[model samples]
Target: MKSFLTILFFVAITAFSTDTVQSQTFPKMDTSPMDLAMARPDRNTPPIARVIYSRPQKNGREIFGELVPYGKVWRTGANEATELTIYEPLKVNETVLQPGTYTLYTIPEEDMWTVIINKNANVWGTVYKKENDIVRLETPARNAAAPAESLSMVFRPENNGATLMIGWDKTYVEVPFEKVK
Candidate 1:
């Protein structure tokens, strides 16, 4: 009986161990990692706006007009489309954007980029609909002083609000935002 009990215990341990190993198949880390950028008047103040996006590495490959393609809407980053959250009403290119969460999409070009603010937020992939667009404005794109290995976005505070700076590879663009009156 003792021998029989020992065999049962061994069987139970093996079965549980096998189940544990099979149940946990950890996924590999993403090549493109998600990141966040925010704008604030000062370090002690609350953020006026925030952006969440993924930073995709250049990997020594062509970026703009090639990997990203020109005249096409890009997610602005890898994986999920970039998300923008506005804490207060702000104006972009004279157009007022009410306080809310939005998606930032861009139509890349050789010398210019069309920035689009959409109503949808936190959606997966680059699934875009023209009807959801809130505003679209043109911003000039220029070559960066040095190649950026990863996609990056930063907000610089101004007297009115802030300017959103986006750079990838060897190109960068600035989008200005001002507090609404």
Candidate 2:
């Protein structure tokens, strides 16, 4: 029965090796991945504003007013706090924000959304303090004709500035800002 014992030993060793390898390997599923979007004034010019955030997929789930909830401060994105960098000073809804990096947070509501730019940056999750907020502007929330499966932020260049558009599911909000002279 030496051959039988040898076969059993080989199977045991193989199973143990497989278990060890699997345990040491990273997880195959990545729930949320980091994403970057930027806005440039001109084709040849450098980006005036940049946003870094993690895109969370819908996954056939109800996003707004449910998963994200309403009237609560959201991190604005997944993983690390959503970050925004401005290369130049800009006026966001008549409030002048200096050229620097800031963390973006939002309070989503059924009718309106409050966009907050805080001094805190590179934070984890929805840990926000009102004392750190630089500006809080309420913007209109519009309904999208089609649903968005993934969260997205876009900058639409206007006459002398750009509008930051944040969209998810079937809702979106736009924050218009002007470049200060």
Candidate 2: worst-modelled 10 consecutive residues by lDDT: 26-35
User: For candidate 2, lDDT tens digit of each residue in 1-181?
Assistant: 9999999999999999999998998877668888888888879988888889999999999898899999999998899999999988889877888889999999999889999999998899988999998989999999988888889999998888889999999999998878898
TM-scores for all predictions: 0.86, 0.84
The C-alpha stretches of model 1 lying farther than 4 A from their native spots are 1-26
Per-residue error for 72 in candidate 1, Å, reads: 0.5
RMSD values, in order shown: 2.3, 4.5
Model 1, 4-109: lDDT tens per residue? Answer: 9999999999999999998898888899999999999999999999999999999989988789999998999999999999999999987899889999999999
Cα displacement (angstroms), candidate 1, residue 60, comes to 1.2
- Please report, in order, the local distance difference test score of every candidate based on alpha carbons: 0.94, 0.91
Model 2 TM: 0.84
Once model 2 is optimally superposed onto the true structure by TM-score, how far is the C-alpha of residue 178 displaced, in angstroms? Answer: 0.8
